[model samples]
Target: MDVLNPEQFRALGYRAIDMIAQQLADLADGPTRRPVPLDVRHSLEDQPIPETGADPFDLLDRVQNEVLAYPMGNPSPRFFAWVNSTPTPIGILGDLFAAAMSPSAAGGDQAATYVERAALTWVKDMLGFPQEAQGLFVSGGSKANLTCLAVMRHVMSEGKVRADGMASIDAPMIVYTSAHGHSCIEKAISALGIGSKNLRIIPVDSQHRMDVEKLREAIAADRAAGLHPVCVAASAGTTNTGAIDQLDVIADLCEAENMWFHIDGAYGGFGILAEQTEGMYKGMNRADSIAVDPHKWLYIPVECGCAIVRHAEAMRATFSLVPAYLQEDRAEPWFSEYGLQQTRGFRALKVWLSIQHYGLDGYRKMITQDINTAYELRRKLFARSDYEVVTAGPLSVTCFRYVPAGVPEEQLDDLQRQIVAWTNASARAFITTTMIDGKTVVRACHVNFRTTSADLDVLLDTLTEAGQLVLQGAQQA
Candidate 1:
């Protein structure tokens, strides 16, 4: 049966739009509200599934009150918990239009396919990748990394992996990444049939950049032991500390060793647009494949990531599966031939519309502002005697610890974690913690486009208040 008549559908749609607009307008004060109570959440969870459809307007009311009342806090300007960003308004609209169109983006010469190609071309242009390179839009960093590494496995196998699998390779296929690299690399390796034991964890330097000397030594040792070095997955920006590995140096080593060079630039690749990171991402364009997430820094909505590869045919060799019913005589290649997905969503429209709304220069200015904000955060922490800037690098993340003068070193880790809890509970600011160099530290990632220096001030003031309260309890204990 039909869900609703045209008039009723329009009414419901308008109401939903109005609700979303109101929420967007109120996001500036989102962090002030405490999270939804557990009882409220459990009540929603305990509801039985309805066999019959309910009234659409009633459901909309429940959604507006129950769901929209509680947000994940990322859209709030005071949120510095992780790499999540506030989506652009234009991008949100694009998502709505895309959903309305509802085109299957897997294959064929459809309008959705062309739009994806155009968006991918813009992504390549932004990253300085060659126009001739092949790319695709994936879910996010994890899938982007997996798609690229799957191609790496195929190419490194010399056309044997697709037919015979990992068993065709004689020597163990080894991959290398820094200790500070994203954990997705190891998971990708394991999922690709390369054992985790074959993944070498190279050491990092004082700045948390990958140690080139240690990497070279590891490669040499692997060669000496008759193992094949397939690829080196370098981090453009690590998660915990935002440290950028030496891309140019690692590129040179990969060239000398004839290994596939993959870059997990999902978190901070867009940092290349900022002048502060001018020389950091020098050789990124030279990578065999690179994974980047527009959702993180480009301010696009969630589930928009790009996988770029210099060798298009290698990717086709890895995942091109065509059935007789889906075959068509078209000049353009289908997106399904490039990666693991067969029923891909139209994720490219949001990226395209967002980038169009904010041109490259506009993006550059925003990213530079974010970096400057991060610097201001460090400057404030540096000026204070109670907090120590622990391991923030040259990006938009700052890892710091609350260390009162007389507090014991053993108690500092727990104290920092407690401060995070207290600050979050205060409903004034939201921050997170991470382990850096075996010490617990508060991690603040500035990917929110709405955040400003004033927000940083609020964050510090709330953190200071939280630290005092937590410190009093620790002292008494």
Candidate 2:
């Protein structure tokens, strides 16, 4: 009888629709994309989960009052923290549609198979990977990177690495990555029993890009010292500074060295969607395997990271397991054989629907705007005297520090940290902190699709005001 109450469900549905619509319409004015409640810690509870579920309507009411009213607005035009998502209205609508129609992406039915494969194909094409390459969508970059390294290790070791562990190897297989590469690789080493000690940290250039010369020397030295150079993991865009490595040079090195080349293009690889950055990623097509996170740039909801390997055979070799029930005598796109997915989500729908609704041109425009806004922010900071850029402008992220003219580095670091603290505390907008060459500094990334140059300016002004307040506090003390 309760399930038969369509009228009641309709009323709830209408309420939900209205609330979401209102939230989306007025998202920009509420918070500038950064929600920092100074009093949150004081009020937060350290309790376990409740024993039972509360009334659905009552829970909805609490959500509306607490969450809806508070500004966790990721879509706000001023969120410039860590890499963020800015899903379009169409994408949001598509999310609703996906929820309504939950297609299991385990490759059984013809319809789900066709659509998800089509979306995966589109992703591979965007990255300029081989047509024969196959992939599976995972939750995010960490998982994607894990899948990639797992596949690489599997192929390089010819199944020995997974079966018998690194101890079974004749020589130490060295994994090379720039110092700036994400820690996920390190985590992969620890988890995969490859030994994080075997993961070689190559140095970077002044621009923070992976130094190809240093890499070559390190590989040569390792080989001379009786180690096998198994693979090179290059960062397409670093998380801290959006620093892209010299992919062309690194690609050449990989070819010469005959090692597996994996590009962790989690941040910048997909910028091929942008006209300016398109050529910068020219060498990505040569990668044996690559990782990209849709959650960061594609503005898809969280848990959407993709991995593409040039040869479908490699992925098949990496994650394929042969059990009686799951064994396939002949080849089909039985997805369980590729990567570490048994029952993966129908993530393709969100990506496919987002691209279909926005089109390539719209996505490009948003990416271009975000890049330009980052440059614009750099210009604004350069114009001011109180702040100084620690590095050159970013294609997507900018790092700067607040220091009065001629201040010593020690005092500058403390003041800059204080400035950042005050600015985030104010909660008008949110930037972040990073260390550049051992000095603490503020790091801003312009990945949010909704953020405009105007939002960047407002953030700049708010930071400046906050800096002045910090100076006043210092004086009072």
Q: Rate the local accuracy (lDDT) of all candidates.
A: 0.89, 0.78
Candidate 1 residue-wise lDDT, 1-477, digit = tens = 976888998999899899989988888766544678888798679889889989999999889877877777777888888788888989999899889888879867787888888898888888889988899999999999999999999999987989998899999999999999898999999999999999999989999999999999999999999999989999999988889999998999999999999999999999999889857889999999999999998988898888898999999888998889777744778898998888888998888888888899989988888888899899999998898998767889999988888888998888888888888888778899999889999999988778877888888988888889887776698
Counting clashing residue pairs in each candidate, in order, gives 0, 0
The prediction achieving the highest TM-score against the true structure is: 1
Tens digits of lDDT, candidate 2, 1-477: 235277777787787888888877776766643453545433334336788666667756765765676655466777777787666666666667767677656666545566778878888877777778887788889888898888888888877877787778888888999888899989987787777898999988998998888899999999999998989999888988888888878888988988999999888877778765776787888889899987777788776898888878878877777577755433565676786777666777788888777777877887777777777888899998887887753468889987776566667777777776666666667777878888888888877877766777778888778777877787799
Quote the lDDT for 118 in model 1.
87
Instruction: List the candidate 1 regions with Cα displacement exceeding 4 Å.
Output: none
lDDT of candidate 1 vs native? 0.89
Instruction: Evaluate residue 300 in candidate 1 and report its C-alpha lDDT on the 0 to 100 scale.
Output: 88
Q: Candidate 2: give the clashing pairs.
A: none
Q: What is the lDDT of residue 414 in candidate 2?
A: 79
